[model samples]
Target chain A: MVSAGAGQAVDEGADSDPVIRVRGLENRFGSDIVHHRLDLDVRRGEILGVVGGSGTGKSVLMRSILGLLRPTGGRIEVFGQHLRDADDVREIMSHRAGVLFQDGALFSSLTVLENVELPLKTHRQDISTQLRRDLARSKIQLSGLPDSSSAKMPSDLSGGMRKRVALARALILEPELLFLDEPTAGLDPIGAAEFDGLLHALHRALGFTVFLITHDLDTLYAICDRVAVIAERKILAAATLRDIEDLDHEWIREYFHGPRARAVRDQTSPPG
Target chain B: MSDPAQMTEGRKDDNEADLVWERGTEGLLLATGDWVLDNVELLSDRVDALAGLASGLDASGISRLDASGALLLERLFHRTGQGPTAAGLRQQWRTLFEAVDFACDDTHEPAPASEAPWRQILERMGRSTVEVVHSTHELLGFLGITVHRLLRTVVQPRRLRLTSTVYHMERTGLDAVPLLILLSSLVGAVVAFLGATVLRNFGAELFVIDLVTFAFVREFGALLTAILLAGRTASAFCAQIGMMKLREEIDAIRTLGLDEIEVLVLPRLIALLITLPLLAFVATISGLFGGLIVSVVSLDINLVMFLDRVEQTVTLKHYLVGMIKAPMFAAVIALIGCLEGLRVSGTAQSLGEHTTLAVVRSLTMVIVLNALAAVYFMELGW
Candidate 1:
């Protein structure tokens, strides 16, 4: 089961074509292997939450798929196009997918409006400056940021507002797929809940396929339709929260039935 | 989800985005093709040309629509002062249009007006004058604090950061020895050669030895070492401390009830203070060796005689004059580096600006202080 192929997880779940598929993924740093034969399939229009303990290579896996880090060995197909054979891998990937990094990597020197407009300036140079600004502003508003936050620099905004700006920049192109890394980390409970609500609403309205990596159990429960647990350098199981909770694995049991998870679960479920 | 499939289908070949206006009977605007970000420019221009004629719009023919495309539609509606009817649109495109409409509803307020250019120039000059004065005040205050802590540490030797001081000494002092020796020796040889050429014309070639000794002992040795340290060690100190400040490590130290000055600045100051004078001593010796080699080879001066002349002319008075300036230069360089580092604000751009400022200030201050000391020593007849 520890070495189960990612194809197996797809066979056992909802019957939808994969948007992002990884097979025989291997990542190694010097002699230390981070992932070995890891496989995953992100289905269309599903919020697939990827979770693991610290140093379990969750970020590494995401980076490999995004082409930020080239894996030592793997076959990756995004939008049914093989990454290695594509003439312009980044061009093919970037136009279709949007990424929200963990720390809201906004440019420190630019105002929020300029940060959001950057992608349009890069990919769609034919768009008039006026239309580009309006589209960026609309996306910012759609991400639930206030009107005042548009003119301020990233350094001037609070952490939560900065994440919203990053999200706006990511969603500017109206990409069909979204990759979110720890979207709710470094936020207070209320702020995290608000962010989760915003993300869920955006996902439903946009209907983009979401590959979300998070450690916040609340985020998983609130938005994710299925959860993929990375362990032993492969996905041990990929299923709904209830099915994952019922699995008799030690880490899964401790993770799902832990005190924190219990508190979140009780709060989420309807009263008996 | 249904729209994305239709989107891929529309993008396959000749189904590119298009907008047409019928100025005939109904004056209908029929939008067709994939209306997404990729085709926004062509779409926006077409929509603008027909904005006034859009009495009735039919969007059912459009193959695909995204938020950006929705924004363009909303803009057209706003320009014509008419609300979007959404009468014949697909369900998904209708949802997208409504969402874009609601989100982009608010109009932007115009930016505040600016002052005239002439008035702005005058205001900027006056502001910079005040800023210069304020910075001078801060520099003096920081110097006072550093001196106060040094005196306190002198009284209680146990308070010194011995480990940190030694570590910095190895980095800023020991590692820089070879580069210092090479530069000093090269400059000394050049001076000796120049002196021999000029002095030989006057039939006083022997005086070249005096020129080499005076130049290296009183000016070149100390000044060169200080300038080199100003460029090298000061920039290093500024960058390292500026990064730590950027990461809030300085604030962390303070929150833990530790004096950041004692933990960070004092060690660098003490290391530079102790090592600069020693480096100057080495520079002076190597410079003299360079002069000796030139005299024996080019000037045909007797080796024993050269040694005797150097021995007699190298008085402690001249040596003291140069050696005394090293620690003063060291203090200025270290303080400016640390001060600029601590002044770094939150952004990476600010850190870079501060690092450059640290090097420029330290280098300028070193040269200015050396010039002042030269005038003072001459007045005192040292």
Candidate 2:
């Protein structure tokens, strides 16, 4: 199913509209500059993998696009609506977007089911309680979590399961745009692969545009439709993996042609 | 109205995409506009109402269709047991809808039934009782380890954390001096004024000096200072330790092969031991001074006469009794605070709960120990 959709998305790439348009993005912390004149476009229905070395501010860019941080200079347009100038656009974007933070960020006090139900309760206040529970339960199952995990605390779950619960919570709203920050960072090899597969399956099922920040080369190879590299205080390149790997830059050369990248490429089939 | 141009023209008036049902011979359901997550809620009720009636679903006019919208259509088709007819959904959207249909088939089982309220309460009570016993055991073990480490450090002075001890003494003791002095003075003056007013009725106004001296020196000074420190320093200790535990710094110390008791608990305990006695002495002096001032101002007794009366009526045993309880109170306060801190688990709520528990436990223990000491001293004819 994912292969079929991936082919279709690639075929339709030329005519697809840009869902997220970022231009002249700048982020600064006093004397420290994180991003400067960064520009990137996330097309509709594509998984855009964001990668950078440590301290390169990939997460900051995601935060700025998500409206969590006000960039020092940038104009961000999501779904053809400017984020900063319009309140209605922001509200619509929020309803349409979901973010899975690193560490799951699940409320330690609330059970998994309650965590998944929180967004529904906030956004759809008129839904009946039983209907809300049903929706939340479906989302949890959709994330491949067992029904038994619904009542358990976040602290009780393993790191992978916690990430699944966070995914369920993020998807509870049936969002059209999903932001994932290092979705498989701390998982073991098998768990990371399973998570990647789950993410691919969900994206195929949901058709949501994904903006994923990751350091894992395998994730970029296995799932991303296009990879964006950040370096030297700006987005160095944003292209298909084939194009990104062939880029002529010092850090890009070492990163994409490195032993780890070679291992990842050798392990996985070439991108479609 | 049947013309496709007219239908497209009508959609321009409504900015939001919607599912429109036609009950004519075609019996068609028309999906128009952007069918995305933002508008799925708007379409859900209408889709549910018309799903059973429509013979065919058409999406020829849809400008956009995302996973959420596709999922809704899949759910509608699943419920009505009808495949979409002439929908003309984009290839990507059709694949997504198919996936949703395949995935949503396995619904989750119902959650387990909750336990009865009375049973839950009883179970919680039993668990808490066990937890209390375990915590007490842990506290005693920690106290023993702390004492052992202190003894070892005393024998080998280089091993002692002298700098940390002095820093804590300045924080918990010296910083507390003004508040302690002020509180003891006010309480002493209040006691003396109250005693003199009552004793004047019996023409024994001069006896107020003896009353003030005895109570302040024997009970009020030590007890009040202990209670105040328990509320103030003990809660601070709990918060500091709880934060460290939450940050895993305590775990780091353990992994580094350093004794947590020696590093964390011993410095605090020793600082309290040194400070509490000194604070107690200061409390006794300030309290007596308060009493002397009250006697001089209110009773018109000269300073020398008030001192002479206190010397004649109150014995050195009273001062000794007050000072003797200081170290014990200090140990209890420090132990309870540090114990509660070590008990902290993950979460800010846990830190807050342990801090409150620290203050309450220390205050209660100090009062109970003071009463027990008073009884013992009384029996010993002190």
Candidate 3:
């Protein structure tokens, strides 16, 4: 870990605070400011999906929270502790924050067993190899992947399978804070829906906060406790899908009750 | 925590759901930007973390880089170095982090490199071409390593292993046999035929047996095989690893707290070191086979006579000299291949270029080492 640097923020939220706070967050490169004093929070145990158009700074914000990107100003306190920028925070947040990368980020060299076992290996060093395998297998099965999927590489697995494998890795750690960068961004309707189902099950099973970033409308409606419509470098509003439907924000009205949103929502709508 | 006056700012003008949403989004931006600005101290921290993490292919017994960059960086960090290795560089990196304006929770990709000129870019390559390649610095790294390791092991005792010795032997040594044999055999057969023709007028064509043995075993055969393996295996290792680097696999490993040398380069270095000598030995045998073909035919020297002559002309010293060349050649080739591979950055095109450079550098290094071995052997009058 590198030495502590400047720009430490003043605000510190409490443990079990439920809300993640952001203050005076500004991201810029040269003269361009992508985020200007943006602020938002995902309450504990809520599935918060962030929706945005291309280049709307949705993923950037997600990366920032995950500490993947250093903020250009501001503070990110997770479960009420300051996470200084360093290379080793992944180990610190080991089982606390699970991330499902866009490409699934599963190692090409590793089989599914090995990939899911990665986080488990980092945290629980005492488990037998067979126990680790069993844990990974269970995570894979919990991810809704078929039995045949456990041995596959990221390349060997289908796109949906890759996403599931990523989800499996995320779940393997049983993190309290989950970040998914476009979990169903590239999947087909059926594939995407199934993936969304897996997310619902994961949230229910883990009782964790899901910081979900996506462009998928149906997924937002299906799983997100509050969908934050990211547009113009700001969160349009973070609210439940039902609240989003009634919102007066121009994009919100058009986005939620919009024809496109309605068409996607109708298909995946659960039985009345 | 909800203030009515702030609510009137229209920013606070929202329900808990909206307030919660807005705060989460806006706060994220603030926190991330703040973290980076606070960390700008890194720019001044002239200590490149990766300096000592590499191994196998790049050790050239040289060290370069003036502390001039340190002077410039110190100004940024507001520090004066007590000495070159003082903690000034790291302190500057921290203090500089204090100055940047960071987005709370944003890490947008900066605009394309072409759009940003110097004085605007923080990219490491933002300096000059030489600054980016660090060629002189890297070439000189052998000294840095020797000194650094010497100090470290003494301060805290450590064990060193040439364990990768076997791996390089396999990848570079074993895998190189078929090609080295094929190429050297052809060279020997062609040389034998041509030598026999030239000697015919003297009515001493059978002496071509001596020519073949001396030529293949003592000199060119082993060198040629080394060059070929350097081109094929060494270059391939560089390009492959370089591409993986560009893809952020290197960063991923580092983030996971793994050493790049032990995890990636050592295995390759081991493969090359172990394999090259084996390949060289094979090349000499194959070249002799090719020479025997001509001795049996064009030179009118029977197989038995040719064998006798080769046995006579080539001594244990000749075999030992070539074998000696193989491991050194292996080390050089592996080192150069790995060096060029790690040097690759940017697009897929850079990977190709680095691969080519790896091959070229390895071949050049192999030739240089071969020459050194030759001179050393000649000095011994063997």
Q: Candidate 1 at residue B240, lDDT? A: 88
C-alpha DockQ for predicted model 2: 0.32
Docking class of 2: acceptable
**Candidate 2 local lDDT, residue B55:** 72
TM-score of chain A of each: 0.94, 0.92, 0.87
Ranking by lDDT: 1, 2, 3
lDDT of 2 by residue, A1-272 (tens): 01111122222245336889888888999999999888788888899999989999999998888877888998888888888744645696668888899989999889999999999888888766755776677677678787678899997899999999999899878777899999999999899999999999989777789999999998999999988888888777777888777767778889999999999898886556
Quickly count the clashes in candidate 3: 73
Q: What lDDT is reached at residue B132 by model 3?
A: 41
Candidate 3 on B106-164: residue-level lDDT in tens? 11122123345554455545565666467647845733543354355347543223455
What are the per-residue Cα lDDT tens digits for candidate 2 across B161-192?
Answer: 98999999999999999999999998889999
Per-residue lDDT over A95-205 for candidate 1, one digit per residue giving the tens place of the 0 to 100 score: 889999998999887999999999999988888887788788889988888666778889888889999999999999889999999999999999999999989987877
Mark the 10 consecutive residues where model 1 chain A has the least summed lDDT: A1-10
lDDT of model 1 at position B351: 91
lDDT of 1 by residue, B147-223 (tens): 88888889988888999999999998999999999988888888889999999999998888899899888987888
RMSD of each: 4.9, 6.4, 25.4
- TM-score per prediction, in order, is 0.88, 0.81, 0.43
Q: What is the lDDT of residue B334 in candidate 2?
A: 93
Compute the lDDT of residue B280 as modeled in candidate 3: 68
Native contact fraction, candidates in order: 0.51, 0.38, 0.00
Where does candidate 1 stray beyond 4 Å?
A1-11, A14-16, A85-88, A147-151, B1-14, B85-87, B107-131, B194-207, B239-258, B345-352
